[model samples]
Target: MRPQQVIDGDFTYWLGDMYALLGEKETALRWLRRTDEISNHNYPWFERDKNWNNLRSDSEYQRILADFQRHWERYREEFGDG
Candidate 1:
């Protein structure tokens, strides 16, 4: 069976984090994107998240990080939460 049902946004985010911790880069990113889509989380802590340190030098990971930055910028502009 799947690791968990991912019954909510928090659970989804946790799975993404777990995958990152396991060094499953592709799976981790897939789950992370799912979490972001479900919760629209800004993921401002991504750069500081130790779980993703292994991905820091990865070009794909950097792209994803840029995407997160852009997403947060848009979110802030829309909600004035920056």
Candidate 2:
């Protein structure tokens, strides 16, 4: 079960990133959003990944970034850094 969770998140993230690099914005966003839903960690890489540079100026991309940040804030509230 744990392995499946890891596999799902990691594989989905790769698919999303690949689609983004291939210029498939809509499909990339769909997979990327699922990566977030299942993994919840790839958001930090959004701004730093050169592969995503092409998506930087997209309105939907920005909205996704904001949504990821809000998700992070909620996570922090629920689980302190410790």
Candidate 3:
């Protein structure tokens, strides 16, 4: 029997980065948004990731930063700053 597939948010996020690297911004954003939703905005890979460097100048990238800040605030409220 074949094992069931588990679509991880992290994996999707990485796929998004790959899409971005390949110059598919819309598709990359789509996947990245899904990743963010699945992770509830707490995806750890975003903390110090370098792959997103290509998107640094995009408005969407700024929005992602804002999302990250919001996630950090929520985390602090829920678990206290670590």
Candidate 4:
């Protein structure tokens, strides 16, 4: 039963990335934000993913990137680079 709570993070991330590649900025952003909340995509992963390239100059995408960085900082403070 405990495993029922686990989510397929990769799938969500895929949806976000796919939407981004399709040029659906708003939809991609929404899914990407949800992916971040559920899976916590790392900076390296974000950087190397070309799917999000279309959003590089987008304000909302930048904001999401900032939020992801903040989460990483908090994680580091608590876990010390686990």
Who wins the lDDT comparison? 4
Candidate 2 lDDT (Cα, 0 to 1): 0.74
For candidate 2, report its TM-score. Answer: 0.73
Which pairs of residues clash in candidate 2, taking residues 3 or more apart in a chain or in different chains? none
lDDT value for candidate 3?
Answer: 0.69
Tens-digit lDDT string for candidate 3 (1-82): 1112325776777787888888888777777776666654653557556777777788886687678668868888999867
* lDDT of candidate 1 over 8-69, digit per residue (tens): 75676677789888988888877766666665465688767888888789887787778778
TM-score-superior candidate, 2 or 4: 4
RMSD of each: 2.8, 4.5, 4.8, 4.7
Cα deviation in Å at residue 42, candidate 3? 4.0
- Model 4 misplaced regions, further than 4 Å: 1-7
Lowest lDDT sum, 10 consecutive residues, model 4, at: 1-10
The list of candidate 3 runs beyond 4 A from truth reads 1-7
For model 4, how does the per-residue alpha-carbon lDDT over 44-79 read when each residue is reduced to its tens digit? 677678889889999989988887788778878988
Candidate 2 residue-wise lDDT, 23-61, digit = tens: 999888877677677756645666587887899898988
TM-score between model 4 and native: 0.77
Considering TM-score, which of the candidate structures 1 and 4 is the better prediction for this target?
A: 4
